[model samples]
Target: MSIPPGESAPNVSTGELNARYDKFVVDLLGVIAYGELSAFERLSSDARYSPTLHDRAALGRMAVTEFEHFDVVRARLAEMNMDVELAMRPFQPSIDSFHDRTRPADWYESLMKAYVVDAISGDFYRAISEFLDQKTREVINAVQTNDESGALLQDRLKKMLADDPRLASRLALWGRRLVGEALTQAQRVGTEHSFLRGLMIEDELPAARNEVSTLLAQLTKNHSRRMSQLGLTA
Candidate 1:
């Protein structure tokens, strides 16, 4: 299922909505925390594939940033008196599967994967943040700010593509594949996590369905623009 817009919880009392929203926040943070942790590991692993010492170190820096992001989310969960490990556990399998299936074949593929996939997920999180409480929104915003990996990946990929126009076709295809798998991953998470699904839609209303379609359209549009920036097809 596509992510629906941030609509009020339907057919619930204020207190009930509050409780549901709290659960939603925890679930959101849990998934994002796990994602950051996974990114840290993946980038560190991908560093070995880097063609230059400078590139390897750059990836190492990004990996550290990801872990720092993870730590921020972990602290938030702890403050909520939630078991951080338990909160992140449910998302582990699906997220791990995503990485396993999309593992890059080479340095260029790794760069594209890191850039395109991370941006898509960031967009999704920002979209969901609209309906969250002020404090939770601040936490989400804090972790996402000052991300330099996207810029680094974009610059490197652009230069690489410019030097060898032949890579455009292959990378474009890879970008599309990454988006496809990302949407699939989103669907899996939404299907499996009821509270997270509740944040997006309410009781399966038609308007809710339309909102979901709109969100998906926006994500796709943003993704296509990102691909264009990288001189690739969406």
Candidate 2:
């Protein structure tokens, strides 16, 4: 991926990379790719709940965009001689569990779930990218790039809450539930994957617990902004 000169990442010494750091990169990329693929599937399936043909088509397009991101991450992994599927395999259970536990009950619920999850993922990726080489960090940021999907969802949700004032409370609770479930799954992933869990400790970035707290704090702030955009309480 040839980024524009203006979009280039900070220069980092390639010599800083070692076998362990390489494993970390491969594993991180694999999980991110798998998450994108899973998001594509979920969004496509959830499109069934769209009330109008246009909405359905729009959601389908969003799903396609997610799959495109998955392809990008997969290509990056392959360039490093890692099998994409193998890289993603370790994260499957945690990701699946998160989705299973947070199944949406309606079109609005699905939209909110997508919004909340994507916001959290974006925050997490931005913070975690610091542990990566410049090129790898750029790849991760590319996958997290926002498009019209967020704006579309935000508009629809704000209108929905306006139409039904009671929805604000329910959806706010739903948002909190989604965050709780997401954090739970994240903790599980860290516990199960030693390399992933040790990314901070081994790299001597900072205390892992403190770093996680900071990540959550950032996610909370972003989540509140998204909720406010949707005319809901945080």
Candidate 3:
């Protein structure tokens, strides 16, 4: 069932807990944990396509970073008395669908995918974290930070764009396609997962609908800014 806009998370007392909201939190953690794990796999495979030893090493480092983030989330799940792997299982279909549909065509495409997709995912997570408790929010924020790969990808793309201005249009199109597929899969997850959809409904009052609208605007703005930073048209 879905909550109306602006309804506070269900309250429980004494021996009771808000099971629905707690489940939502667990599901969020699961999605992110599995996302990181999948990222590790994808990045590792992408490294095999790197043109130079240096580039491959850089991708390898980024893969390790992804696994490290996955471990952190797994630890958090353990603290919550949840089965980490089981919790992550429900999220795999959507996350995997996103990655499978958007697999990069080459080394440059992989770099663009890493930068654009990661930034978009990060912004989306940051927006959702606002609805969570302080501890959970902190965990999500820490997991969402873009790492050295972001910087390396930005620099590489900038140089490439500078050297061949025509490449910008193609990469820009790829970025747009990435965002489109991501949104498609995101909508599927939201529809299939009631608790996740509930998180967006800030309260029961009709006026609270603005919260979701505001959130969408914020995500879009952050995305446009990142695209600009990468010297691409959003």
TM values, all candidates: 0.90, 0.87, 0.86
Model 3 segments more than 4 A misplaced: 1-17, 195-210
- Candidate 1 lDDT tens digits, 10-54: 565556555666787889899999999999999999999899999
lDDT by residue for model 2 (84-183), tens: 9899998998898789889999988998998889878877877888765789888988888486777887887888888888888889999999988876
Task: Using TM-score, give the best candidate's number.
Answer: 1
For candidate 3, the lDDT comes to: 0.77
Query: Which lDDT values do the candidates have, in the order given?
Result: 0.83, 0.79, 0.77
**Candidate 2 wrong stretches, greater than 4 Å:** 1-17, 195-206
**Where does the lowest 10-residue lDDT sum fall in candidate 2?**
1-10
Ranking by TM-score: 1, 2, 3
Q: Who wins the lDDT comparison? A: 1
Could you give candidate 3's per-residue lDDT for residues 1-234 as a string of tens digits?
Answer: 244233444452322224556778888888889989998999999999998898899889989988998998999999999988999999887888788889888888998888877887787788777767788888887787466668888897898789889888889899889877776665576557753543433344344345555655776677678889977898
Give residue 104's error in model 3 in angstroms.
1.0
Instruction: Give the Å shift of residue 21 in candidate 2.
Output: 0.7
Best of the two (1, 2) by TM-score: 1
